[model samples]
Target: MALCSKIIEHDDTGRYLTINQIYTEPFPSAAASGKLRVEDNNGIVWILSYRVKSGGTRVFSGDWPRFVQNYKVKAGNTIVIGMNGTGSTDHKIEVM
Candidate 1:
């Protein structure tokens, strides 16, 4: 299932992808609280730290910048995060 589909912001390409409260609740258990295994469309697995900041905002940091770099992601691109399968810790990301 798709967790969220968001437009990449300038700051998101810099250090992390910030997800607002509306999108945070659907994340799988592994991604909602700690380190998550995110596999890009290219099948590259990136380890990103997932945390809820004050005010209920969520973020995926750590290697997120690297992922942006590798994909040449930019502002206005649509990024989608979803579960690879039911009850799986693996998540899939696609940039379009």
Candidate 2:
């Protein structure tokens, strides 16, 4: 029982996103697939992969420093991913 069909992404301005494009039914395995969408300062959108269970972004990347430095993601800008989860997990993504 985990967050399924989830997505997470950040923008050039450091705005993060997490959306559920799949579901309406609990397939579990079906929700395992990643489905993230991000919008940058330029208004361009990007799709991010789902965070793998407990392993986290280790399979992805750890860019807290880089993310903090590059984007103003806090407060209204604080990017949130995996709403189904604790929402405390930080998935690293280097926005280029």
Q: Please provide, for model 2 over 8-73, each residue's C-alpha lDDT reduced to its tens digit, 9 standing for 90 to 100.
A: 334322433333343343323323654444333444334443344442321222333344455644
List runs of model 2 lying over 4 Å from the truth: 1-30, 54-70, 74-77, 80-96
Tens-place lDDT digits, model 1, residues 14-96? 98899888733666575445888878766678888888777778888888889888989999999998887633346888898
In model 2, the Cα lDDT at residue 57 comes to 24
Clash number for each model: 0, 2
TM-score of each: 0.84, 0.27
- lDDT, each prediction: 0.80, 0.35
Global lDDT for candidate 2? 0.35
Clashing pairs in 1: none
Residue pairs with backbone overlap in model 2: 5-31, 7-36
